[model samples]
Target: MTNRTMTRRDFGSKVITVSAAAAAASLAAPAVLGAAKARVVVIGGGAGGGTVARYVAKGSDDIAVTLINDSPTYSTCFFSNLYLGGFRSFESISHSYDTLAADYGIEVVIDRAAGLDGNGRTVTLANGDTLNYDKAVVAPGIDFKFDAIEGYGPDAVETMPHAWQAGAQAKNLKRQLLDMEDGGTFVICPPPNPFRCPPGPYERISMVAHYFKSYKPHSKIVVLDAKNKFSKQKLFEDGWARHFPDMIEWLPLDITGGVKAVDVASNTIITDDEKFQASVANVVPPQKAGQIAQDAGLADESGWCPIVPETLASLQVPNVHLVGDAIIPGDMPKSGFSANSQAKVCAQAILAELASKQAFKPRFRNTCWSLITTDDSIKVGANYEATEEKIAKIEGFVSQADESDEVRAQTAAEARAWYDAITADIFG
Candidate 1:
């Protein structure tokens, strides 16, 4: 958790390709056209939108770019778990968009994007102002399916925090954990497959266990998962067994019965077979693309937006692109790294289309790191290329189960370095 261990050497090659700034500069410029440059508008100023706006605007002064976000600052979901584990403070993960406006000359609008008029090629904000654009990029993250769970909704978040979107929910979850008494039971109800950050729930459990192990040794943690297996299942299971054997228990779907409901008043989760009592509950419900995507007609029946892999343009709406947690990215997990990588490809394609440049093959990469314990970390990543069919995975790497302590420590350091680099790349 110390900055001294996070060094340039620890990251080496992995951090080099994560940023979009250089990639934007490397794009081939179009032949001198006397025509007025295209106006591009980006919605939701998080990882995807921020990177796209920065890259496209910084790539060329001719193009007029406007970035619309509901808030002036962004809190990353990628490293929020580290905050719970006492590795980082909330302020450390929060970022502002001031540099994007000042350095890149991109107009930053702090307003909620209420509607998208694809037919008219305009984005309407909640304040009654409209932005007309030649091209649009929508990267609004996921929205919870409150109806998926019987007793948990937006109101229930006050008691049982999902902490999936970061910010206040994350702080609330941390407060709940700190309030629990010694020997109290903590329950984590993870969502099903295809959710954001497949390994996130397990990582949260690891962090909670780490916190309890240091202070309340008798505290117990239970994972009530909707799926039978999870990402990096063996690595997580191995780490749990090695570090906190009797303190953590994992109940898969079949074993615990599917989650039927929750009784928030009693701090209990109800399954088909039995009920789980908890001093605190972390219920991660099913999710879908943010409502704006659905309203814009970019999302399909699956409740996720589909995109042309090479250009990242929306399949249903022309000149509209979708990225981040809202898009159905084949062979890619919904992580901040994936979103930033996708934004680069998306930005390049947008600039090329606007400038009438030749098309090039698109390549993408993503690496997700999870801290199993204080100094023990694991990672899973892959390199992908766009094909006629889908974003096919070309190669992959993951932390081994029986790796040396030195390797694990290095991986943890690499994760911290990545967080620092990626946040700088996206925000600055």
Candidate 2:
């Protein structure tokens, strides 16, 4: 991996028809009659919640907005893989909430949202304080299903290093790779479909392979996937064959015999058919909506929140909305771009619902980039529109198999540009 790119984390034009910040004059709520301005409380300051807080606050002078996050600073999961692959530093992917608070007039609360009283229209923080809200946007993102993988739970992360959450664990995974012997084997177990970043594990393999090839040539990598096929399957197969033949091996679900369990002490992943020993084991367990979403009673039996496509309003609870990997958004892969896009639409819907402004049609978009080797990247993306039923895919595109080196380099550049732009759009 090389020291590479940065830009906006999203692509395509955003069509917004929002009124001026003074649109709340037409608000039909009790706040319009000499009450405190309507309060909007956003939980989880990621691409989705942060953007919503900014957009809603930026759109209305009559809404007092507050963003609640567990952390003081936000670290993006989008480019954390680049950090693992040695392309970017840890600091590059981390962002602050100063701008979201100071510039957008949003009160950024550095505390976890422990409970939500939808009936009372209030969010209870872990700090024992309750904040009332006219509307609440819940974007707690994905939390790992540690119980899904036997012998690999929260206690085992320090050893096996799932690194899926992309913070200290990412640093831990990187350190493990650096400390391994020259010919040591690294094993990765990807979760089942509908997980965040469908192509993430494969890209991790690519980046890790790049690191091993450059520093430890004889090292080996094995992928024990939970699914039979994966996103960008052919493209990744082609890139692996071209760039690191004999260095990596991928066994699909039927062939890999589905992950049965693991032995964290021995760095071994036990399967239905065999056991894989490795110097490093990256076991990304299955995931579900963050705890707050589940605790708020917003999630269904699927452990994910269901939302109305147009407004992103929760189907389970009124005056509550969901976004990012927490929502079962139709036809949209869980990505930062998708979250950012959904937040924009969600903010508009909230604005309209809160202040009686006309809302625009909801459109969503997502593009995912993976680096195979130095200066070589593959991308897949799609455009979507919201119908009464779901968010339907309008069209899509992916990187071709037999592209030129110049074109691949250009694709890598495009990914870098997206990184720079999306981070700014989400953080600033």
Candidate 3:
């Protein structure tokens, strides 16, 4: 099958994407309830939750949307690598919910969701406030499984920053790199499969390499992987060889024995066959659904919430829907683009169910872009359709290894434009 690539350009950079007929029918709230407003409570405020809450609020006037989150501003994980590489700043990637509140009339509650009563349709907050809702969206994102790695947990976070959550930890990792000596070694330990941003760890390696090559020319990078291979493996290997040369050395589990333990106090990674010392260590452990999701009984034994493919309705919780990394998205790779796409499909489903709007066929799309060097980038993407069981990919595209300089530069430009466009699409 031919690779078909769809982007924000295809939909004019719109956030809520539904068929035209269905969109027309959903412009206004249906006059089912004379004066009563349906309540929608959204937990989480990253790409998925922010987009869904905004889309649903814009879908109808007779709907009251309340967005509950622990943080006032959300720092995105999508472009944090660029910050590490010195291409972007932390402030540039962070976003706030002011627009969703001031313009879209979404009640942005900056408080943690302490408890969820799915059967009662009530959400309890950390401040002891309870909210009743007709529908709820659970996009709380991922929480690290600290116990996955021996001798590593919350206590070790400050020393060996995971930086996966992309906020203060990201800053901490960047600071550690800046503080290290010229010839010091920086170690990165990536988690196993089914983690957020499948290609993220590799991208971090690339960005860090870019940083070291410029400032600390003698600095070295070592990767300790739990898996044998990674997403865009060939592309990453090619980039590392061409750009960094001898500066990077990757050790797969079979070669390194395995990631047995770590000593954060000394920044030492103790594998079965060897012990590696580092000036700084980034250990991204295994992850599960965020704590609130688990407390809400949204996750199954697999530690992920399973949702109906068509509606994104939580299989475990009635009247509650989930999107983003916390959910078991079959073909999706837990990316911001995937979460943003899923949120649109979910918003349309919510309108159809609660506001009596025509239902549209759900189409999901995702693209992950990684920067290799200045004005050079590669991307892999696929479009998905919802089935009875899973979101199955229809077609996909990837940047060719032998692409011309102009093409790679164009790909990088596309990524930057996408970040700007998507942030606008979600926040506005």
Candidate 4:
């Protein structure tokens, strides 16, 4: 089937169908006051939770869906680097939940989920309301380990912003970059392995370089990497060399001997071999699943939720599903695309188990695109299938360093188009 942009009319049609089916189901059931409807509570409102809630509510009238998120509006982390680079505006990435509630009949709650009782199948909201659920989906994104690097914590984010979660943090980082002196040096300390968005730090460096090349021409960027190699390294290096020559420097752990600590007040990063100072210090610390997951006993010793790959059901908690950055996805990188894909498969599985429908074969796909410059982009993508052991990668594609200019431009356009389509799919 060909993918087309969903219009307001399409959404209206879906709403009508859903309402009619729900009415019919209610009338046909013998139980009183929604006893027949299966309750599903989604514990996040970003890509994974929003998509799952929308799909479950739209696909089945017999299921009652409630989506709980802490914020009134969602700002996507996926395109935040572009906003930092001045390629996009903050308003463009922000989305509202009005449509999800009004159109899809999802009960949208703008409150933090304070606790989860898996045994009792209840979720406790911050306001002291305990809601019961037949099944729950937790898609809460990454939480930073503030103390992973000594002397670095949430209080120091103002001086050295991670901005990994987007919104105000991203804006702050952009403001810092804009205020830096012309010849100043900017430093970024990427997080260790098994964090959200594997290629994000490199993409950020590219975007920062793009900004420095245009506004602060004399400014430079230095990457203090925790890992020796990174995703799409050659493509990023080539783009940096070609577009922002001599403006970006990457230091691997082997060279810098890994970061020991950070001095936010002095704007310095301490490594074994050297102490580097910078005008801006963007330190992305190590990460774990959102705190609510850990509190709910959904996470294991690895600090990530373990799930059955085919169904996305929590290994520790029955009738609960884990998606997005919170789950251990094996070969799949923690990305919005991966989360959205996993949500669909999970929604289908939930519907099959509750609504007595046949389960569909599960297949997941993810593509991460990085903008090197304005209209210069590259991408890495893969298709996966669930095995007895894990979700295994089957086929993959990547943009090459030697690709032609036309191809790179087309790739950038594709990236922008994807952002539009995906946000619409998730938010609408």
Candidate 5:
């Protein structure tokens, strides 16, 4: 097996000979191994769905996994702020599903899920196809609450792109940012509690301010935050003072009364106490679990679906697991990293259930990175433990507020490395 002992021709001949032998064995043993594998239907092909599909398919020879999604490609919401700030391209964040299907032997269906028949244990696609499964995993992410803000709805997203989901909206927001003149104001309205990525809006402001500091030096970014305090507040504020100075300003809920209305035509956003006009406005509205989850009766009055922590199975039903932003795992922030980690736990729990073994205790981890400037970055991360009722925080975690310059820089590097590694784990 020494590398110097084999020539290219000999290697090629040996590969062909091995392939022929395997083919002959498969053909001869047809009756012994021709049974169809057990089917696992996964809905939504974002971080959670893709990871579970790949892991389950690769983990077992008796399981066949099918992933259903609305789009062929997915764009990362995590790094999209960089694109909006003109630091990265769309292709850098976009990923395809081909690798999951081809390399892992998972069947990826590019179609929307119209509904779920929980009782029948089947998922109905938009095209009227029904897929039955022994177990189903749903990770449909977040859905916007159009009526949460007066005079704001789906139609308004065209001009005031939330840019939260990262796709066309992200591109549109970037265009608006570029179209603005120097010294112009950019207004960003962050949603209330329990939204996807708690620190996302602050990070966005930091990144956008980074852009303004370099190009439109006189420009200002005003954050109309609905919450009194946000994730990584002290770190973000320190970063702003050290980096952007007066370029970025934040108005808490009490000061701004929260963004109540937007006059799209005049490019003005009205809060309860004041009215502000801007060259560009980014309004991230209140959110709920994706529509599919709501339609399946998985969501409660609070707009989030509750699940049993250890199994991630819906509290309302059995055998249906909910992961990612869709599930209300207590104390867990809704982020892609959270989703990916939870999906693995769900997969292991499902395998245990199938084998009639005690389900493994679930542990989770999440790390979120924000680019403060071209050079500096901030991050918050934690580990979680699951009980019968809720997912609680465990030890071995760090926050940006606790980091020194060297630690922050090291974390920034880890952030980029993590992005590459996780995307590879999802798509590759």
Candidate 6:
């Protein structure tokens, strides 16, 4: 994969060379740079990748960071549910990497990573160019297992949008909602356990129901859930009855077979007991680490990359760290907040490693919010501690499982505030 040339579309603009004077002027305090400059290659410039690049570049002057992603702009999946529910526009979730390159001095490359040779510390891009690095951080996010369900693949998504990754799919789903007539059925199939954002499916249903209340009051949402219990279930259930009474219906795994098959053209979903046809269907398939991670030999048979808890460095490969949805941090939900928290810990560890210092102890946190309706939200949050082999949940840190009017109101307010704060941490 070496010696590959990059086209204009592949690499975007060439690196903006900064003179020694400019570089020196931009340097942080003397204490920040504890070692000689080292090149850090970060693959995937989304929530995790972008945060790591910024932190590494801003945490010390001695690190030259480069972020490689397939897209020039990233639209977050965190707040994307709101977009699908028609509460926010697509522009609100979309973000550019220009600021990361120019303001933070990160070399941004809009190229897909084809493979990683961790032993050699080199990453091969889709265009065949190979990037050598002192250390590499990978946060390639989630990939759908289309085959997990019968008659469903990338092609099926065109008619029935999952909108799981946001961007175009989000728009597609939104358009479908608008096209639906009154009294139409909107089917939502949430995947099995251990997927990105445990509370996301419930939140999505809430948002969609919110739209129905005003525009299509007779319309209903049928949730075909693969799990018996979900994050903040009681809160979401209560909010649904309170706000959109009878508009939202949930079919647990016992009755639905968790949506085993789908006929997109016919809008038919085959369940255990019977088949269902809907005007619109959103099928969130089972997921693993992104294909790039699996292709790079980072993923094990479990479809996730495992890492040393303290540094997030791959246990299979030295000097290469895996973060975000790609890595299986035990007991942690794959959410943007988890990725951001892990990125900060990863940055600290990388800085220590660059200076030939002891690894920094890593602590991770995640707070996931679900909108039960426009005015009501439920939340689940946790903090974690890293051991030598695995990351475990810290005692006494968990989301409220019970339902209360006061708690729901507080969560709704905090959800909006958290979105603003987290986005600022990544883009601002």
1-428: candidate 1 lDDT, tens digit per residue: 01111122332222223134643554422223334445788999889999999888877666877888888889999989999989899999999888888888778888888999998777888877777776899999998889998988889998999999988999999999999999999999999867899889999999999999998899999889999999999999999999998999899998987788999899999998899999989999998998899999999998889999888899999879988999999889988999999999999898786655545679899999999998899999999998876677999999899999999999999999999999988988
In terms of lDDT, the poorest run of 10 residues in model 5 is 1-10
Which portions of model 3 miss their true places by more than 4 Å? 1-31
> lDDT for each of the candidates?
0.86, 0.85, 0.88, 0.87, 0.81, 0.81
Specify the highest-lDDT model's number: 3
Q: In model 2, state the lDDT of residue 29.
A: 60
Query: What total of clashing residue pairs does each candidate reach?
Result: 0, 10, 0, 0, 0, 0
Instruction: Report the lDDT of model 6 for residue 300.
Output: 91
Write candidate 5's Cα lDDT for 226-332 as tens digits.
99999888888988998888888899999988999998988889998789998999999999999999999999998999998887888986668899998897888
lDDT of 3 by residue, 1-428 (tens): 11121222332232233455763564433235334566788999999999999999999886778888788888999999999999999999999888998899888888888989997777887777777777899999999888877888799989999999989999999999999999999999999888999999999999999999999999999999999999999998999999999999999988987678888778898998788998999999988999988998999988889999999999988889999999999898899999999999999998877777778899999999999888889999999999998999999998888999899899999999999999988888
Local accuracy of candidate 4 as per-residue lDDT tens digits, 150-210: 9888898888899999888998999999899999999999988999899999999988998
Question: Which 10 consecutive positions of candidate 1 have the poorest summed lDDT?
Answer: 1-10
Question: Candidates' TM-scores?
Answer: 0.91, 0.93, 0.92, 0.92, 0.89, 0.89
TM-score, cand. 1 vs. native: 0.91
> Between prediction 1 and prediction 2, which has the larger TM-score?
2
Stronger candidate by lDDT (4 vs 6)? 4
For model 5, the stretches where C-alpha displacement exceeds 4 angstroms are 1-35, 355-359, 399-404
Query: Taking the tens digit of each residue's C-alpha lDDT, what string does model 2 give over 1-428?
Result: 11111111211011122244544445446345434466688999999998888889888877777888888878888888889889999999999888887788788888888899998777877777777777899999998887887898789899898887778889999999999999999999999977999999999999999999899999999999999999999999899998888999898889978888989778889998799998999988898999999999999998999899999999999889888989998999998899999999999998887755578888899999999988999999999998888888999999999899999999999999999998888877
RMSD, one per candidate, in order:
9.1, 7.5, 8.5, 7.0, 9.5, 6.1
Better by TM-score, candidate 5 or 3: 3
Model 5, position 309: C-alpha lDDT score: 86
Q: Which is better, 1 or 6, measured by TM-score?
A: 1
